[model samples]
Target: MVRWLLVLLMFTGMADAAPPSLYSLLSQGQYQPPMQVMLQLEQNYPGVITQFDIDVQNGELIYEFNMLDPDAKTTVGFAFKASNGSLLEQKVAKLESDDLEELAAVTLMRQKQLKFSQLITLATGELDAYLTEAQLDHDLGISYLELKLLSAAGRHKLAFDIANLRPLPLLKWD
Candidate 1:
C-alpha cells in the first residue's frame, strides 16, 4: 500500500527529518519556555492554543504558538523571541467551520485537564522517543493529538485521545 511505502521511506531515513524540540532549548537553560507566554496570550485573547514549535530563522530560535480565537473566528500564529519570550510577529487567518469544531473539542479537552506538553513528556518517556512536534488534530469526528517523534527505530507519527491520553489507531513506523 502507499501508506506502507511512506512509512518505509520514513523509517529508512528517506523522508525529511523533523526539527529539534523547544524542550531541548529549555534544557539548555538559555531560553525560557514559551508555554508561559502562550498561556498569557490565551488569557488576554481567550483562544485555544493548538500547537507550539521552535523554528530557526537566520540562526535565531523563534518560538511559534498557533491558536484559534473563537470570538474573532480566526486562527492566529504568534512568533516569539526564544531568549526573552518577547513577541516578534503575529499572523491571523479566518477559521473555517471544521476549525471551529476542532476548537470546541480542544476546549472540552481543557476541561479534563489535558496539557499537550505533559502528554508529549509522558509519551516520550514511555516510548523512549524524542518529541519533535505535537499538534491538535481532528479526523472523522475524533479529536486527537498527533505526535511526531524520533527514536533509534525511526520517525513515528503517534495519535492519542485529547482527553485521556489513550492511544488511537494510527500509523506506527516501528
Candidate 2:
C-alpha cells in the first residue's frame, strides 16, 4: 500500500509539471503573440523590425523587438507583455554620424561577401560553437558576431568581425 501511494504521488506530481498551453497563458493575462504587438507598435511608430524574439525577463514572458527607424539611422527596442500584448518598455538611441557611415559601408560590403551562416562555418572551422548574437558596431566600424563555445576547458565567448569574418578579441567580465 505504501509503494502504491508513492507511485500515485509521483503520477500526480507529473500532471502538475506539464507545461502551460497557449490558451492557458493567454487566459491568465500574461502572454501574447509578438507579431500582434509589433503590428500595434508600427501603427504608432513606423519602423522595420531587425530582431524579434520571446524572452523571459523577471519571471515573465516578454516579446522583444529591435526596430530600425524609418529614417534608417536609429535603432529602437520595444518590449511587450506576452499575455496581454501591452507595452512594457521602449528604448531609442541615436547613432553617431561616424557609426552611421560605418554601418552604410558594412551594408554595402555584406551584399558582396559571404552570408552569416557561411561566415559562422568559416569562423568555427570544426568546433562546438553556436552563434548567440550579431550586432553592427558603428563605433568600432565593424559588425560583431558573438559565439558561445564549449571546449575542453569550458564555455567561452568568441567574437568575430562580420565584415571580414576575422576573430575579434573577447572581453571577459568577472
Candidate 3:
C-alpha cells in the first residue's frame, strides 16, 4: 500500500505548470480567431480555466478569464505517517489583465440575468443621465453588487477580495 502511494506522490499530482496562466496565454494571443484561443485554454486547463468572457475597453476588445483550480493533493504533501512533506493542494488565484472591469462588464452584458433596464434604474440615483450602461447579475448573491459596478461607463472595473476569494466552479448545485 505504501509503495503504491509513494509512486503516485512522485509521479502525479503536480502534473504540468497549468499551461501558463490565462493572463499569459491571452496576452500573447494575437487578434486572430479569438474563439480558438478560448477553446485551447478550455482544453488545456480543463477544470481550471472555466470561462472566457470578452468586452471592449477604450474600443479595444478585452477578456476576463475565469479559472477554478481544483482541490487535489500535490506531489510533495507531507505523509503524516512518515512525517514527510510534499506540495499538496497548491492553489493561488491570479488576474491576467488590468482592465478586468471592462472585460467583466462585457461578460456581464451577455449574461441572461443582468438586464440593462434594471441597471439604468439603479444608476439613476447614483449617476447622471446615462451615456452608456452594462450589467452583471450572475454573481453569487454575496458579490451581487459587482453587477451594478460593471454597467457604469468610465467606472467599470473589477475589484475582488483576494483574501476571502473562493473558487467559482463551473459546476452548479441547482
lDDT of each: 0.69, 0.56, 0.33
Flag clash pairs in model 3: 74-88, 76-86, 76-87, 77-86, 77-87, 78-86, 134-151
Q: Compose the digit string of candidate 3's lDDT tens values, residues 9-94.
A: 66986543444433333344444433343344445542333333444433344434444322321111110110111112334444
Off by over 4 Å in 2: 1-30, 70-72, 96-174
Q: Count steric clashes of candidate 2.
A: 5
Q: Residue-wise lDDT of candidate 1 within 1-174, one digit each (tens)?
A: 999999999999888765555444434657665546655766776567778766777546777878876677889888888788888998999998768656866776677765555655555556755455677877677777777765556667877776656777653334
What is the alpha-carbon lDDT of model 3 when measured against the actual structure?
0.33
Clashes in predicted model 1: 0
Best by lDDT: 1
Instruction: Itemize residue pairs with steric clashes in candidate 1.
Output: none
Which has the better TM-score: candidate 1, or candidate 3?
1
List TM-scores for all candidates, in order: 0.64, 0.40, 0.24
**Runs with alpha carbons beyond 4 Å of true place in candidate 1:** 1-29, 97-101, 110-131, 150-156, 169-174
Best-to-worst order by TM-score is: 1, 2, 3
Better of 2 and 3 by lDDT: 2
Using alpha carbons, what is the TM-score of model 1?
0.64
